[model samples]
Target: MELTVTPAALDCFRQEWAFGDGEHIRVFVRYITEGDPPFAFGITRDTPSDAALTTVAGSLTFFMERKDVWFLQGNRLTIDCLGEDIVFQLL
Candidate 1:
């Protein structure tokens, strides 16, 4: 599985990544909504966990759930901060 973090996304992450000490951005998949895209993404601060698969791009670090790896494979996505929403564009 692979993910692409664009320059715009990286800048946004840098601005919002204010977790203290050892905490970092954790990207997780949630099945909360039943819409066109069945899965929802979440980004939050968390300490490194044994189950998380780690990936780093530029200055940003991402922790993804092992189970979510299959879905993310071959998907190139861009994260853009539009007001209060973090929009993911599939490229």
Candidate 2:
């Protein structure tokens, strides 16, 4: 439900999404579910938000306010700025 983002990840996010727009990030998440009828889930930002982030899973979509956006390795993560230690909880 939570992950600590790395510094390297933060930089990449800055380049790809934050390079031109000071207002938003062109980010999304993908999820794969195993079942007889396998399913794939993806959540792309529909509205520009400097304060909110969300993703889709199963029958629900989770959302929280974004405090900071950072990247790690080959991935990106947004932190709950309202929390301590850049906590990101996906629920």
Candidate 3:
């Protein structure tokens, strides 16, 4: 598994969220019964406890927890900005 954060996204995080270097960002799965995909991904500034995968993009660290591996396995995850919002793409 790999994680990529675009420069635009990094800039958004820095300016909007005040995230600094060495900060830990978590990507996790969220179940939504009303959603088209039935599930969605969410991001947050969090500390690693039982991270199954980790990657560095720019000055920030992005990680997925052990329980979230099922959603991330065998995929390349990219964090990009669409307007002022953060978007997650799995490829």
Candidate 4:
């Protein structure tokens, strides 16, 4: 698995979330049966309990816990901004 945060996303995190140096950002998967995709990606400010993968962009660190790694195996996950909202893409 790989993770990438676009420049726009990094800026959005800094400006909107007010994230500072060494802050941890968690990437997670949640099931929502009502949604088209069934499963959705979520981002939050959190510390790692059992990080399976981690990457740093700018001053912030983004990570996915061991339990969530199965959702993203062999994929590149990208985080970006669409207008004012955060979007996730797998490539």
Candidate 5:
């Protein structure tokens, strides 16, 4: 699986999530629908497992469950922090 995140998105994530050493971003598929985009994504703090796929972009470490790879492959994600709301976009 491959993914890309924008600088603006990275900054937004940095401002929102504080990471301890060995901790990283975990992307999970929350829900899937018949509607547009078809899936809902969420972020949580976690450490990678042996089966997890990991990637580093800038100062961010991202981990995705191996089972999720087929779903997230080739995805581009954008994040924006608006006051207390964090917006996530998949392109």
Candidate 6:
């Protein structure tokens, strides 16, 4: 439950996904391990997915694929498959 992403990165995401009352933008992350640089890669597609969006305590969660679910906050995101190994801090 750690956070990665710089202020700039957060800004980029905010600007990129400025949803105006339609559907909440969902952030989906997956586990992609590479040699010497094992990390959880990010897949940000503008189009919506089959994943359902549920709001809890002001946090929008995508509970479709638990194996690769990305607990997101604003532009800040954290994936757990890597045991908090990979960080995508906006930078």
Per-residue alpha-carbon lDDT of model 5 for 1-91, expressed as tens digits? 4555556656666665654444578877776778987877778887677445666767678777876666656766555556645566666
Expressed as tens digits, the lDDT of each residue in 33-88 for candidate 1 is 68878887777776555543666667556676666655566675556767545676
Q: Which candidate ranks first by TM-score, i.e. highest?
A: 4
Give the clashing residue pairs of candidate 3, or none. Answer: none
- List all candidate RMSDs to the true structure: 3.0, 12.4, 1.3, 1.2, 3.2, 8.8
Tell me the lDDT of model 4 at 38: 88
Which residue pairs show backbone clashes in model 4?
Answer: none
Whole-structure CA lDDT of model 3? 0.88
Which window of 10 residues has the lowest lDDT sum in candidate 6?
55-64
| Runs in model 6 lying further than 4 Å from the true structure | 2-10, 14-23, 31-33, 45-64, 69-87
Worst 10 residues of 4 by lDDT: 32-41
TM-score, candidate 4, is: 0.92
Ranking of models by lDDT: 4, 3, 5, 1, 6, 2
- Lowest summed lDDT over 10 consecutive residues: which window, candidate 1? 15-24
Off by over 4 Å in 1: 16-23, 50-53
**Residue 64 in candidate 4 has what lDDT?**
95
Question: What TM-score would candidate 5 get against the native?
Answer: 0.65
Q: Model 2 residue 28 lDDT?
A: 36
Select the stronger candidate by TM-score from 1 and 5: 1
